[model samples]
Target: MTLRSKPYHWLYAFVLIALSAFSVQSVAETSMEQTGELQLWHKISLIFDGPETSERADYNPFIHYRLNIIFTHPATGDRFVIPGYFAADGNAANTGAESGNKWVAHFSPNHTGLWKWQASFRKNRFVAVSAKVDAGVSGGFMDGQQGQFTVSESNKELPDFRAAGRLQYVNEPYLKFAQSQTYFIKAGPDAPENFLAYQDFDGTFHNDGHKDDLVKTWEPHLTDWKKGDPTWQNGKGKAIIGALNYLNSKGLNAVSFLTMNIMGDDQNVFPYVDYNTYDRMDVSKLAQWEIVFEHAQSLGLFLHFKTQEAENQGLLDGGGTGLQRKLYYRELMARFGHHLALNWNLGEENGEWFKNHPTMPQHTNERIAMARYFYENDPYHHHLVIHNGIDYDDLFSADSHYTGASVQTHKADFSSVHTAVKRLRDWPVINGRPWAIAVDEPGDAQHSLVPDRMNPAHNNARQNGLWGALMAGGWGTEWYFGYANEHSDLTAQDYRSRDLFWDQARHSIAFFDALDVPFQRAKSHDELLSSAADYVLAVPGEFYIVYLKDASHQPTLNFKNFSGDFEINWFNPREGGEMQQGSKTTIQAKWVHKAKLNNTFNLGLPPSTPNQDWVVVVKRK
Candidate 1:
């Protein structure tokens, strides 16, 4: 009667036993339900009926049972083994149920064709936390069930992730969409790290008495919510959902939020049902989070899941990859990893730091282990990065598992942004793999990015933080509000407080989009400029972008290594508009040495805005 002796017979007997275990009425109930638009890059959910379990059960449904769905594209033989989760009653957000027989898995098919799937449900003492695929004995109901579905082409257009496909790390300095092959450059918020500490979520954090004052209502953004938007529990999520709408309206493509912060700065955010309960998860709270996340994807916003902060890095498994860490990561991947664009940020300021108390630091081995777990477990294999408290020198080597770096620079004027970005871009060359660098935190902690009423111009932010990162071949930036500023990182409810600054960020993104140049292939060549203060990013003889931080510093390009007939155009970074003709419309390049004659081509002045920063775009015509 062993499973291996006669596999098909054993499966049949298992099914019969499972059917007898439940009443005839329960056995007649549908075992599985499929939902969502069955199209390419759209989420397709498979909800199955399993053993009825509770979040507070002695068997711990979160860690004692395992569900993995093996999905295969018949055409290309591309298979994705996606993880599944326990969904209480299959409608926990609306019903607020604590126990049920529902288990679910989500899949976003990358190709448009027939796809086959099979469920593998297993049970053991602690099988959910194990990385092994076949870690436990079979649990019968839908264990051997097989099915097929068809995915058609998506009709979604711009600003919808379905139109662009998944944003993947393709061994470049930037992430590119799989469908469009368009390189991505993000601009968004990096502050309010406790974004999930909302009042509507189902958790005990509001009354936990640990930084309960930091919980947010997100009241100001309720007006931004439009008709046909998604909400839950008699319209409980409008304010938070509207905040995402405002960010998209501002042309921001990315957002950063923390999932767990038990002992961190704002302790009101965590995924557990209770503060001290780590093994059990609040099913309804997580379901509400999925609603917000799904809306963000539809709006084309990248999710930055900062798993922990430095203060709580050691709260689970003492900063090692153990049982607690595995279960936490498993729940996240199962529930939200189906989104198109996201990066699993290991931790914010991951290393040791001291403000009022000292935090535990994860050594190089521990850090790599944590990253390796996600790299191997996540079915999508989305971009992986780690924020720095000190630096990323240890991860610059060839064995590193991270695809990018979430940088934090400490400069009030953001003067160090360029150097930090350039260093990350250059150091990884020896390993033959470049890390996509993003300046997530630009300025100092006390006065990073102030409100528009405080500094409407945002001169330093535009000149140094925005343009500086772009000119140095950095992918993008996310602004972090200083703690001392109004609407600071932890307590901010309104996004319009930095209204003027969002315009500046939008202008920068617009300039890049309008040019339509292959900037992803371009590299930083600051040494080619006459003034070291200015910056030059070029694809050698193809296209060039020269950023002049000060309009007073008239610089020239060293055309000694390049030769072509080039057209020069001027652009205003502060106020985005059409490209204007500069003082010099054209220049003929010829090879000449610096030691010999004036081999440099004078870029000349901008057509207008002579006192502010300007970007000069030169292209071979």
Candidate 2:
């Protein structure tokens, strides 16, 4: 029953037709420019035609050649220096070429008008740092090139990364999209670790013994494959691309997948030429992956790039500062860093938990070094976060490159999500920088978030998984399907498994957006309520949201030293209903229920739905 052994290979032709319908727009143009005319925020690639060199297996081209491009925005005089990478033939996605003289530089313009670029190709014995050396003597044909192009104003509509401009981490507790002033909140899947195990792309996992049965056709998402969307080589990625569509349609905005999972769980996804190989990249395969990522951006989906899984921590560079790991990271940034909205996760549960593992858990300094590399290299400076295992508490540091915490827990009821988020949110402030925290992985390992078929109500998941994180001022939660469940994390092929839960997630987002809740400025205080079942995220008198976790009885809120007339609204968290009117209550010194007092009030709220989770929102009148 493993994916690779599945006989869905016939669907390859079907996917090709689906992908080709949209890829006709991206089909290769006969020109030196790898990218054609692009809108603002769209990536434009400049390809330097040159002589093909040794294969990735034969020699490390990453160390021998360096391509640096500086693009200057004419209007503001803002300079952007971005690194370039080797693209084999520039059509490697379809051609699968391992050798070619196609060196490419990709740029996403911030503004429209004439932009100038200059390329400097240098041959270096040590690629990590550039020193004064022979420049022109060993350079190839594309060296010392210059060009200019006009960036037209983008015409793309909402939900696209183009509309959002760019997502940046500005040393804040949350990530904000550039120019939009909108804080991001994500809700999506954190399962099917082998998300890229599609049939069309170039990968060795299909023949590899570990996950030969792990092939996924993504058949359920086929209908979401819209025409005119980008795809590669004879419809290779229709189902997977459609998966993004299905998520977007359901109102989920973020998805996580492993870029390289060699020697780890599933062993079906990676960027290299084969499962066992590390240094050599499969150029064509990477190109195909870019196509999928591009479509996701267009759909307003956030890309979560998990670089390494725990099992393979010591596989490359021996989990130390080494050249092999540096090259892998460099290639990833060059090829995918141009993306507008993405977060680079250093590893999945990254630490040594087993006594027999080759590498010990990464030391604090090693983790800091990794973060510093991304901070220095990426021009856009997208959000950076690290997933946790047992060493979760050790990752909090004010000086680190991490912008947030990608939290994970083994509590199926998600009772710890709120407390975990609150702790990280408060702990980082001591270092003078607050970290944006997201419970990316939650629920117990064995029976995490099961599908709607088995648990249509999704009571505990809805009560704690969705609302718990949101009320705690945590950005979002991505449901992790448990391994012991039917559609577990590593084996899920259909997303409908959690259909009902997705609806609840959408409801949560809508609630915040509709009310324009200023969650960014609020703090979580569970002590505000007398009952332990109630939780509050409030700016005190200005606005207060009290979540009734138990939904059993009417709770009295202690708004100590609060005196004001307020409007109260009740919301049913479980049923996804509209706000219902609650008693018009005024707070004073020692008001009892609705009676006004001198300077305090213990406001009593009636149940919106008996025995169901509810949210009580109070705003000053």
Best by lDDT: 1
Candidate 1 C-alpha error for residue 1, in Å? 17
lDDT of 2: 0.76
Residue-by-residue lDDT tens digits, candidate 2, 1-621: 554575885586678677765343322321356575577888888887654764463446666677778889879997887888878887888787888878888888888898998776666555523423344233435555677888888877778878878887766776787756788878888888788877778867678786777778888888889998767777778889889999999888888888887777787888887777766778888888888888889898888888887787777777764677777888888889889888999877877665766454665766777787788777787788888865556656655777777889878787788888878777746365577888888888888789898889887887777788888888888888988878788888889889888988888876776675667788887787777766888887677888886646766666666656777777877666677765545443334566665343344554444566778787777
lDDT of 1 by residue, 115-165 (tens): 999988888988998877778876666776789999999999989999999
RMSD of each: 3.6, 11.7
lDDT of each: 0.88, 0.76
Name the lDDT of candidate 1: 0.88
TM-score of each: 0.94, 0.88
Worst 10 residues of 2 by lDDT: 22-31
Residue range with the least summed lDDT across 10 consecutive positions in model 1: 21-30
Evaluated at residue 349, the lDDT of candidate 1 is 89
